[model samples]
Target: MIVRIMGEGQVTLDDTSVIELNTLDDELLATIQADDEEGFRRTLGALLDGVRRMGTPLPDDTLEPSELILPASDATLDEVKQMLSDDGLIPG
Candidate 1:
């Protein structure tokens, strides 16, 4: 799955679903700026859960050619962590 933050308060999902959460986004940024790690995580989780409830991914067979992709290459745990830390999402 791929997640992209389009702007301060908008999140675009695979170029299909565009969601606007201005209030939530502001709160998240505030928490992040204040170094409230738990608050940041909770808000992020809620945003993620909202998208998941929308059924972003239909099914494997329903995806278009551009949406389909191979799995990530095998890597050590630390390597994967570093990769994720460097980029929020892996390239498709």
Candidate 2:
């Protein structure tokens, strides 16, 4: 899975990481829905960190279509809220 962290390029996460990503996605979605800024920030950081850990970074020139596009590290709550989908950031 090619996951793109906005402003941070992309990473190719393995298929095995889907469930883990979904968990984080669901958590992030809840935080956003509840307007929990602290939770949102924390979850976003974890999610991004997870992606970076489980996936290999793609080269700058290897711009392939991303499977998921997450908010930037510095994204605001409102900014990330607009990026959410019914299934959250990481699709099932």
Candidate 1 local lDDT, 1-83, one digit each (tens): 33332221222254333235334545655665566767766765665455455435544444243321211223233443344
lDDT comparing candidate 1 with the true structure: 0.42
Error of 1 at 62 (Å): 8.6
Instruction: Please report the TM-score between candidate 1 and the true structure.
Output: 0.41
* lDDT for each residue of candidate 2 in 1-92, tens digit (9 for 90 to 100): 88899888999987888677888888888888899999989998999889988989999988999879888989989887666644456442
Kindly report which residue pairs in candidate 2 clash with one another.
Answer: none
Model 2, backbone clash pairs (residues 3+ apart or across chains), number: 0
Q: Model 1, stretches more than 4 Å misplaced? A: 1-20, 58-92
Highest TM-score, which number? 2
